[model samples]
Target: MESTAIGLWGVPLAILAGAIRVSTPFIFVSLGETITERSGRINLGLEGTLVFGAMTAYAVAVMTGSPWLGVLAAMATGAVFGTIHGWICKWPKVNDIAIGIAMMQFGLGLAFFLGKAFIKPAAPHLPSIPFGAWSSYPQIQAALNINVLFIIGAVLAVLLWWAFRNTRMGLILRVVGDSTDAARAIGINPDRIRLLATAVGGSLAAVGGAYLSLYYPGSWNEGISSGQGLMAVALVIFARWNPIGCFLAALLFGGAGALGPALQSVGVSEGYYLFYAAPYVMTLVIMIITSSPTRSLSGAPGALSITK
Candidate 1:
């Protein structure tokens, strides 16, 4: 009876903890997509990249006994995938959307085929900092146990925001995104710029994947991503392409995601399954509220194919 009473209080703490944990992947993926779209291109195949990165991270960790090394390996493979997508989309006749779909399918199939061997092995999980050590309550301690990647993602958001507004590279990227003709007139190679941007984006998305397989779920599973990669595209739109905005939006999505499990923990089992739809419903509502058939989204890159 006493534990049940504690459980009631634990519900909010659990949700708070879950929000931070779940939001980490969203932060990385959405920020990555932001970079890609900011370069006047989009790669819808990050879903595949996320899945494959999970598989690769798990496999490498199992082999090398170092989770950090696995993350580096995932980034390398993800960049390669992004490079391929960028190269194909640069062709005049190819469609970026279509090519992105193809790449996604290829990544999924490849990951599945290669991931079978690593499923049974136990790899080292990423370490976390006990921010809750100052608390006497277990729930508080648990809620405060922060992951390193979450901190990294937060710092990255601020850095990207600053870089976008103040750096020379940011100027070039903005010029390319706003107008290819403008970029060319300025003697900038838009294609090369976009390719690099996409590569960097893919690498960041893979870090999100690494977080999944090496930390949260801590396994190499084909189903780990749960469509987070695809939904992040919507997240980017919701964020208005701002890195800091992406971080906040990711936390909102993560809170929605945590709703189901949080309620379950507190004995609110009735209709708990419905809560799983919270994030999707939130996404739909955000899309409806933000989208207008008459005009491109405010802050969208002028040269972006999606906006056109």
Candidate 2:
């Protein structure tokens, strides 16, 4: 009876740890998407960028035996992908969303083509901070191996939140996103701002991909990313374009993701595969709840087509 009670208590605690673990990628990806969407551009090709980033990071780490170099390589690749999306979108009559989808296909193809040789290679893993070193339990230690990207992502979110409100550059970005005419009146180039924003967003999203390959799953393959990239798009909407909200929402998603495994551990094994859909289900539910068919949701940039 005592063991049964202890198991029940442990379930929630395990879920919390799982939330922290699973949320890291969402946090990074959603934050990256937030920046792009804030600039009135959307990169649906982030899925491709993410997978390619994972491939690049893993390949570089394996070749150089340094995980940090892998991260740099991933960032560079992501930037290139973003630049491509931006460059193409600058053409008249080109749809940014469609271009994004195309980029996704391009990214995936490139990743698979280049990553064919890296399928069997072993790579150095990212270093984790020992937050649970004081604990004697193995589960505690496992949880403590929290990735550095998680901390960096948290700090980045706070910095971005502050920048959006208090920085000159951020103001310009807002102007561009809200209205191209307004940006032109202020001597700002809307195209340039959006281009830069998309590039940065791509770079950040790649970092999330790097985290997945070099840390969590700690491997590389065509399948490294499931629907994480697409799900991040939905997360950006649920967060209402708030970086802080992105963090919290990602944690909730992570917890939802962990539900199946956590439940399995306690002898509840039915519907295991279905648990994977919990995050998506939650995202859809939130979108329905917050959506306004008649009026745009609050804080949405006026120039964004997604809100329309």
Candidate 3:
């Protein structure tokens, strides 16, 4: 079947499609970080974790011929990385930021060294839902081919938003985030809560990585994450640690990320490359606008060191 081209109209369609496709990773990473930050901890090493997860997922998919298994493997490894970071930061006098940075380097180096063998092998890809089947246009079909993980991420966001407002666990997380003394008064262990939160965050971040290698880019590469993991830290702040906000913000960021590729696809070659930087530029702008020397961000966790 021949693809139906719609001329200039393809640009917006491509961007709409790309936004959904590219936003999946951002959605996952930002949601993961939202959970971690809400629990009063920050993991700057998520970039390393993201890359390492991509490598792990790709390697496993290549060996096992099952992308789902690869995703599981990535999640397990990510949780372990998170556990290490959480445990180290729990030590007296240890700085979470410093430890997070170290873990990021460690994850990156380990992934690069071990990923060398599987770089060239083709891995099984995750399946997508063909929502555009009724359309005759190929671009519409491509745009509507929604991945399973994207749906999962969307559901997860709603679930998380509800959980934060209506669950006992959410209450505990909030208490711990607000104050260690308050958590202690309530017979809760702040360190334990933070550790578990970090581990959960790591697992989710890894899922984002798996989406990259097994779905979108569909390959293992050293630079696959494109600093998206680090960017998620900023995204969590941008979303005010709200799961629903994270989802919407991820979509916006995804659209910005898609700008360059969408323009190039439409034959707008000149100056299109610069649009690739739109997401990062947007991040910087958001940070500058939100930051204030005199007042802490409204939704920031009281126990979070960055807020202090």
Q: What is the C-alpha lDDT of each candidate?
A: 0.91, 0.87, 0.92
Worst 10 residues of 2 by lDDT: 1-10
* lDDT top scorer: 3
* lDDT (10s digit) by residue, model 3, range 160-273: 999988999999998899898999997999999999999999999999999999999999988899999988888888889899999999999999999999999877869999
The TM-score that candidate 1 achieves is: 0.97
**TM-score: which candidate is best?**
3
Q: Between candidates 2 and 3, which one is better according to lDDT? A: 3
lDDT of 2 by residue, 91-200 (tens): 78889889989999999999999999999988999988989899666566665668898899889999999999899988988888888799899799888888898899
What lDDT is reached at residue 40 by model 1? 97
**Tens digits of per-residue lDDT for model 1, 12-73:** 78888989999998999898888999999999999899889899999999999999999999
Could you report the Cα RMSD, in angstroms, for every candidate shown?
A: 1.4, 2.0, 1.2
The local distance difference test score of model 1 is 0.91
- Prediction 3 global C-alpha lDDT: 0.92
Residue pairs with backbone atoms closer than 3 Å in model 3 (clashes): none
Model 3 poorest 10 in a row by lDDT: 1-10
